[model samples]
Target: MKENIALFLAILYLIYRYKTYKNVNKIIEDRIENVHRSFFKRIQDVLQCSKEDAEKVGLALDKYFVPLKSKFYKIDNNTYSFVDEGGFKGSFSIDQNYNLLTLEYNGVDLLALH
Candidate 1:
């Protein structure tokens, strides 16, 4: 029947839309995970704290400064920079081995790269 065919097509369209939505969500999640994982690991190593503790500090900073989720820059092979959605901004550079080399937060150089 014509109605049966139309129903099947509509269902297929819905399924396609759902899958697209899921894929977009996954991409956004992966980007956030990458930003947090590498940057937070550097913070943890430099501060010499447990992963949990470093995460706490990172979360606090995010809460306070409100980083712009979509604004990211690759400073080098191992370093990245980001800007806050609000007033604060910061940047960090890592070494060849992925160690924290420098950190700059809110116009203050927190660490020296060399």
Candidate 2:
């Protein structure tokens, strides 16, 4: 009887561990999705380009610069700035509705270029 109880407890513990693992994975996936929607989707909308182009520009900025942390800063209620590790800089502005008004890279309009 004792051996049977032990086996049942072990099975319950495994089930609990599996559920916890799945929950953690789900949380991680949600966070990643949020980042993508907030960052990359915003870029795509502002640039008026495909998702691939926006991602290419984002990845290029990260990889082309020196191996350091890139950063974004809110310049105003509607504008944000980006600075790469290698001293490259860009900025974008959005309206109250969060629609992108303008995007510039190195003082040039990225939308026009795109």
For model 2, the superposed segments whose C-alpha errors exceed 4 Å read: 1-69
Look at candidate 1 and give me any clashing residue pairs. none
- Candidate 1 per-residue lDDT, tens place, 4-62, comes to 99999999999999999999999988976988776567556654567876566555445
Per-candidate alpha-carbon RMSD to the true structure: 11.5, 10.7
lDDT of each: 0.64, 0.64
lDDT of 1: 0.64
- Write the residue-wise lDDT of candidate 2 on 1-114 in tens digits: 999999999999999999999999999889657654455665555456577765654454333331224456667666777776778888767655445467776777766664
Instruction: Pull out the clashing pairs in model 2.
Output: none
What are the runs in model 1 whose C-alpha is more than 4 Å off?
1-10, 66-114
TM-score, structure 2 vs. true: 0.41
Model 1: worst 10 consecutive residues (lDDT sum): 63-72
